[model samples]
Target: MRTKSPWLLFAAIFGASFLCWKLALEPHARSSGELERAPATAQVDVPPAPRATAPARADATPSAAPTEHALPPSKQRVRVVVRLAADASAVAALGAELLRVDERGREHAVACCNDPLAPAPVGPRELAELLRAQRALPEQREATQRFELAEGGRYAIAWHAWRHVPGTLTWRTARGAGEVFELRSPFTCEERTLELVIAPEQLSLDPALDAPVIDAVTHVTAKDG
Candidate 1:
């Protein structure tokens, strides 16, 4: 028998090697590429969540202004003292009132005869060039506490006018005709006692030529707080 050629044997070996690479090595490389690409495409997208925060704070309440008038009221006593010019002449009072004064010296009616509890007008008054500017209140009716006395021989009479808060206050009285009289000085609310002194000249005729004239109105005090 003749021996096989060396060249044919080499060709047969190369052919078998090419077949194994195509069937096994190429198929495994394709499968690995598909697996890697599948993992990347299957990922899902998600959104981030929001953060929490606190709300703002506010004030509890607002402030207010002061009020008028006082609390826990008290009573006031009034006394009247009159002097006659002579035995023949006489003196008496028709009505009386109490007035409260402010820093501007403006007068406010605290008590009146017709309406004893009338409140003072609330507002600024027109300014004038007087030591104490007297302002006219709206629909302002003349007020009095109550003064009923006769021109009898009696020299004085004592009565009560009720509550009178003592800040800067004075008394007003009707002299005779349309005459109006006020106390000389303002009084504090301490003792709250007002003693009105009427002179003889105010009630009757004038005194003698040489006689000295006295004050028209005056008030006496006991003690103060």
Candidate 2:
């Protein structure tokens, strides 16, 4: 018999070692954590049904309708026309002409044209009396006597005469010694259009002009509705 070859001996030893590992070695070793526990079956939950929303109907009316009483349409514009004298002679002439104008002839005659000494209207009379008393005191007389015209003229007259002048109360221009015309309305009226005609160079400059006389005529306009 030939001696066993070295390779045959090595094969026998390796096969026996593998068989021992499979049976005895594997049974004795402790198991890893993953291998010992069975993999849990994957859990899946079913979702619930969604609720449905209703759509808007065509018959429903909206909440924002407008009311009936809106404001009246605006007027384009409103105005007052105040005219100053165009000519001093014309204004003076108007004062003279007032004596003949018949509308309120009696009132004008005594106060304006005929008698310069006639007493004034009741309210004006009281004022005149007060002024006369002041003038009699001497200190106030100089101031009461002379009134400067805007166009550089002065009238030196008794206090009672100035207080009784008719045109001064009614907003008229006095021409000479007879004429007086109403410049504007003293009542409530609406004029859609107004044309102011001022006389050429009639406006004057004198510091002594009475402010109350000018303001009562020119500044006030009737209030609007």
Candidate 3:
């Protein structure tokens, strides 16, 4: 066999090594370029989180409807004339209070009329103040004069008689409805009469029978004939 030349053998080995390095390096460079150029994965649009909401309440109360109505004109009036009488032997003066009573039995004083002997004007504000003061001083005197009644509702006539001696007083409506009250000397006698007045749209009581009549025991007199 002929011996191979040393130079030729060396040259062959060097060429093979260079070829292997080129192949390995070229693949690595290509892989790096591919990574740099690859489009960034489309940023997935993350939807915003939903907002929190409050739950509806189960026990909320509904608003109430108004219960007040307009009052009728003053020209359409329910005249309430009052008369008082007593024994000729006695001297007396009578004052009256008109009240509105609701279905619930709550009393609202609507008007007050004083006898000519003790005259004073009592309005809604004055009556309210008197009532408040009465809680603190039950014996306080409240002065009042005649007032107009406009609205129709259940009403009451409270009469007070000032007399010189202890006695009894009688109260009656023109319709024959009546009540009695006891009087004390030096102090006033008080009585109440309840009556219903129909609305303007309905039949009303006879105007002639709409007055209140009061009578007292002997020795006492009434200012109003």
Candidate 4:
């Protein structure tokens, strides 16, 4: 008799294994309906369905959205313009000081500027401009300062000016009777503008040329929306 081939023996073992696996999966596939059959009777297992969650309580409350009213007060930009009038051709910038006042009638010097003042030399054309504007002397515009002011804050401006005589083209560094513009401001709101003018006629300046009076017209406006 001829001996069995090694290839024939391997084929017999594979056929027996395939038959055992088919018999074991057929019973579970029919009863549970979980295992699915694909092409050529390939088995595929299916997972169980997820459980349902319980409903929320009827007494539960929802969250609310934020509003603009919850924001803090914003700061405002403050601009102060100062102008001086005299017959002099040139004037030196004596520096201006800004004061921040507390609620208890106390003042604090905050900001200051030493920028040079502008000069207006007199001439035939300048005379015409002065005559057209109905002014006795050419107005000397000085440097401006900007600061950030808070809401519901109090402030004052104390400026120093050098002494100069009217109709004289000379400007000296000798300072005279300089006064402070004490302000009880109502800047609680950000929508306020002020224009304060102190002319020659409004003040009784010193007769002596050594001590000239401080004449200033300050215009402050809020630069905020």
Candidate 5:
């Protein structure tokens, strides 16, 4: 171990082959160069996948129809009752006027009785002394009027008087059908309960006239209940 100069046995086999390639091939080539620069495991940007939707169909489209003076079919609630007889001292005071005719003949006065004892006299002997002081006293009376009618058709009631009175007018029908009229003195008559055919909740009327002055109408139907 002392004659070693072949350059110290080639420098002890070149320092035991560089210390066994730095402990086994430089620790597996420095762990494959630290798994190639160890930082390539940071590459994230993944998102893409989603699409689906379809549903809705059932025949749809249709609406509009109603107009022809499209408003007049709602009115029902009628009640009228009137009764009067004459000869109460030759009528010394009395008055009445009520009118309502429709079927296109249009004329609606409604109701009134007494209230003109003056302001309407220009002559004719002061309107025959105001119609002889409105019949010098005496009147048998009964008058009840309530109105509203519009539900479906035909209606009429016309009674007039300036003198000469007698009365009776009735209307009923909810199915009982009973219309009576017996209004005398220039009332003339063709009968038909003064014309009526109403329908939709039913008819109603009552009128009385016993002259001194009278004009009347009765027909009804109303609603709000």
Candidate 6:
């Protein structure tokens, strides 16, 4: 066993210290190179866009127009008066009413025959013709007759024409002709006792006055031979 010298031990320790110092210096050099590189930039804020209120449209519905005729009533009553012209005139002259009232709450008239249940026309031509024929009838003549006023004497004219000619009649608000008639008759009788009365306003018993021509012909058909 030879004793080791202090100098040899010192040399060995110095070699180990040098190796640790080299390893520490290499890492510090790498960190210094990274720091020298470019620094990162900061980010900026941006606002969003606004949205639209109304979008593209495809289809839509339009409003409708108003009507002229009155709606059908729940309860309705029609009255007709047939009067010979003479009687109707007499009633009008005396300032007396043309309608008459009965005990059972029914109205009667001699000057004007009241038909409470008049029918309605199918179409415009039919309506005009109905009105034209009705107006031309003797009903108006009797409405002006008689000179006495009594109860149940409220009279009105109404008619229901079923048939109509295609090319014969037409109707317009201003001045066009058609077969549609506004079946509105005057009311002037009020008698409870009389069961039935036929007071056509006028008696146009003249044969010369041909049947008021409608569409160059009459609506009714001729009797078969």
In candidate 1, which residue pairs clash?
Answer: 112-144, 113-144, 166-189
RMSD of each: 44.2, 49.0, 42.0, 38.4, 46.2, 43.5
- Winner on TM-score between 3 and 5 is 3
Give the residue spans of candidate 2 off by over 4 A: 1-100, 103-133, 136-178, 182-225
- Cα lDDT computed for each candidate against the true fold: 0.29, 0.27, 0.33, 0.37, 0.30, 0.28
Provide the global lDDT of candidate 2 against the true structure: 0.27
Model 3 quality (TM-score): 0.25
Per-residue lDDT over 1-225 for candidate 1, one digit per residue giving the tens place of the 0 to 100 score: 136677667768887877887677664447767655522211111111122121111111112222233442133223222222232122112233334444455544443334323453333221221112112221111222432221111112212211111121322222421112232212223222233333323332222321244664656678632
Ranking by lDDT: 4, 3, 5, 1, 6, 2
Give one digit per residue, the lDDT tens place, for model 4 in 1-225.
Answer: 246677678768998877887877654336435344332311111112122132211111112222234443354344544433342222334334445667786766553232222122322223223233323322333434554555345565434333333444333332222223333223222322322222332122234432344684566779643
Worst 10 residues of 1 by lDDT: 54-63
Which candidate leads the pack in lDDT?
A: 4
- Writing each residue's lDDT as its tens digit, candidate 5 over 48-125 gives 112112111111111122223444234422333322323212221222222444556665544322223212342112
Query: How many clashes would you count in candidate 6?
Result: 73
The parts of candidate 1 lying over 4 Å away from their true place are: 1-88, 91-93, 112-192, 204-225
Q: Give TM-scores for every candidate, taking all chains together and pairing residue i with residue i.
A: 0.22, 0.15, 0.25, 0.32, 0.17, 0.15
* Alpha-carbon deviation at 218 in model 2, angstroms: 51
Best by TM-score: 4
- Ten contiguous residues with the weakest lDDT in model 3: 54-63
Q: After superposition, how far is residue 57 of candidate 3 from its true place, in Å?
A: 56
Instruction: Provide the clashing-pair count of each candidate structure.
Output: 3, 25, 3, 0, 8, 73
Name model 6 segments beyond 4 Å from true: 1-73, 85-201, 209-225
lDDT (10s digit) by residue, model 2, range 74-184 = 221112122333331112111111121344443332233232233454232333343444344422111111111112111111111121223233222211221232322
**Model 3 residue 95 CA deviation in Å:** 1.4
The 10-residue segment with the lowest total lDDT in model 4: 55-64
